[model samples]
Target: MIYKFCPAVLLLILSFSPGNLFFSETKNVKEIAKVIKTSSETNEEAIYNSLNSNQFALPQLESFKEALKGFYILKEKGLISKNILTLIDFSMSSNSKRLWVIDLTTNTILYNSLVAHGRNTGNEFATSFSNSPQSFKSSLGFYATGEIYSGKHGNSLKLDGLEKGINSNARERAVVIHGAEYVSNSFIQNNKRLGRSLGCPALPLELTDKIIQTIKDKSCLFIYFPSDSYKGASKLIS
Candidate 1:
């Protein structure tokens, strides 16, 4: 009886041992850290650092953060189906390659090309945006890539604006992505700025097919501008 009692006591002591407690606490700590790392803002900063270190021409970190934030939210909501993210930095001058097509899954830059804003937006920089039909001014915010259609622009990709009152009228405005002779380097050298689109985010005629194919079909497209009003009011990114 005394031997059997000793074995039970030993088992109870081991169950309450510091080593057991240490293992349980360590596991809990790891789980907590995993949750924090998964949702922390530092994750965005880390991704930006990774992209920047890769030598790809990336958008400003602030803009990239906002773009990434919105991208995640949109993806969670099932608005964006693809892992590709297209960012058009309207804050940058038209002469620069402000359009960045990124592969989020692979963490690589697919295309860094010149994308033209609406003619009424600005000459060198896009300062104005509108969602009104025929406004011909580019609308700022998030957009979902729509079906590819052979319209007047030829093999154009339609864009479904996601932000209401900011760019929801994109389809009605016919603000699609298409090839444009004016969106090339030659046009920029002659005009001192890239040619403007009616309201479309026009791409170089040469890259139009490739970009349209890659970004089409429910990818995330974010037209970023450092506007206080848009930032404050945007329901998606705000």
Candidate 2:
């Protein structure tokens, strides 16, 4: 007679039989996990102070800090390389300059400019989001910036979403950072809001080059929205 082991039991046996096979980071994982757990609480006042000092809008600081927690966890997991962080506040109205690129290492804001959401997201605000291709809706979560390419939108930067089930399909959707004529004050004046993209984070034509160069190649980008689904399901956040 042969004794058969259950899958769960086998997994438990393998976990104990490993030299750091079950968890790669080992001791560092605990430190990182602690940071993530206290992120919202420990970071609130300090992040708000920094945002105020930097002249970043106080209303957006909460979302910024929330996004930073995920970024920190991703960094600790060896997901992103550069200390450059990009943020998109989809909760803001379409006309607001809601995109920010910051150097986390130097604590400097590199760019804060108007970026368009998907055409179908909303008229002046983005509420609906998706990870499906052709949904033409912006997906919320952490992303890693990829290589640059010159396409029909001129110079553009590719983005790879890091989170599963939320924004993992970003690359397949062709959702990229590209320049657009409509992401300007003139367009906003004409239409009462900035022109939206095909789910791409469309930037101003003039600044795409500089922004792309700074954040390209494995940098982190976090598209934030106050959705309950994302907040509950995201693995990078506590």
Candidate 3:
């Protein structure tokens, strides 16, 4: 009787042992698959490029790429209705001070003119300031400072997180596209240096109005820089 009972007890203990317990292997497999799918969806080329590049080096190139990515994404998302006209590749020179208008739809270089930018002396970061004056002398960079006219000018295109401040307010800064005499090829030939603006992108006075009109309203205008921070922030270029 004792022997029979001992054998029965041993069999019962083995059945409940940790080694004999069956884990849900299928559940673990499903979880891993879900993680992979999520990673693939969010991993775009923009993210990879930004991560690999040096942040402080080659700011202009990075900025241009980002601007491109931004426009491309906007088109993809149906935010922009028209085709890109051009990608002006300027910003190569510390004293370059020019804007290149490219025909995005045709890949043609429409115009390359001398332009003026912010004084490299005051601030390396050409910031948009409120309380700044409006005249050419007062214009820090052709932008109006303050909250008085936050959403009143032009159509409010969403810059998303790219630019600071509101669209309406941006107009008050008077950052409209314009031209300048100093930005002409003649000026470059004579002076051997591109002109500088307070902060507004002043183009050749000859082409300023036309370029403004062409890119006014709903068109996209990208100002490129080579900062690593900009590259990481934009989605247009990889």
Candidate 4:
């Protein structure tokens, strides 16, 4: 005489209801995750091999692996939305194309370009990091992309930091991805490094709009550095 919904019924509905799964059953997100406890090393090797075969740089393989680990952790904790991920490898020189926007569904790189760190971070390399408003330094760890808007820098993408004590002051610091003339090949050729931003991961003017459009809403962004502090303090990755 009455309708009742229990835990098992809810799970069943979540698992088998029509249009419940965003990805196809043949290759779903969880299947790609491979989060088994005993198979961690095996999974890491598979991921590394896959990344290499997909044209990602061999030098950045370690960072790529760490990014995947963070992605899996956040995905399991329900902190991510889409399969697309944007990774900015600050460990590389500013003259290099260290920013990568990857499509996890197809395991391909959609965009690879140069990205700028904070002005106060360094000259040709980003060394120091911060999460304060006036620090004028880049922050490390995972970030969830937010809404897009047209601001002083034309079209900009917002970011919400997900790590405590690592990058949680992103909103207060106003670290959005926007275009700048300094983040270009001309600037790098002239100065031997990409132009620095005011603590924002500024992109080149040509690819700004397209990159922002692709990774704008609910995508994952990981600003990676091999700092001991980040490795120890980042709850999202560590």
- Give me candidate 4's TM-score against the actual structure: 0.81
TM-score of each: 0.83, 0.80, 0.50, 0.81
| C-alpha lDDT (0 to 100) for residue 146 of candidate 3 | 16
Q: 1 or 2: which has the higher lDDT?
A: 1
Give the Cα lDDT of each candidate: 0.86, 0.82, 0.43, 0.82
Question: Can you write out model 3's per-residue Cα lDDT over 9-118, one digit (the tens) per residue?
Answer: 44544445354344744554465456544443343233324432222222244444455556656565655545443233344552443355544565444565555555
lDDT of 1 at 15: 53
List of clashing residue pairs for candidate 1: none
Give the per-residue lDDT digits (tens) of candidate 1, residues 1-238: 1122234344544455576668787775565455554444577887877773256577888888889989988998999899999999999999999989998888888898999999899999899999998888999999999999998889999999999899999988999999999999899889888999898999999999999999989999999999999988799877
* 66-172 per-residue lDDT for model 2 (tens digits): 77877777787788988888989999988888988888776677788899998888878998988888988888889999999999999899989898988899889
Worst 10 residues of 4 by lDDT: 29-38
**Angstrom error at residue 100, model 1:** 0.6
What would you estimate as the lDDT of candidate 4?
Answer: 0.82
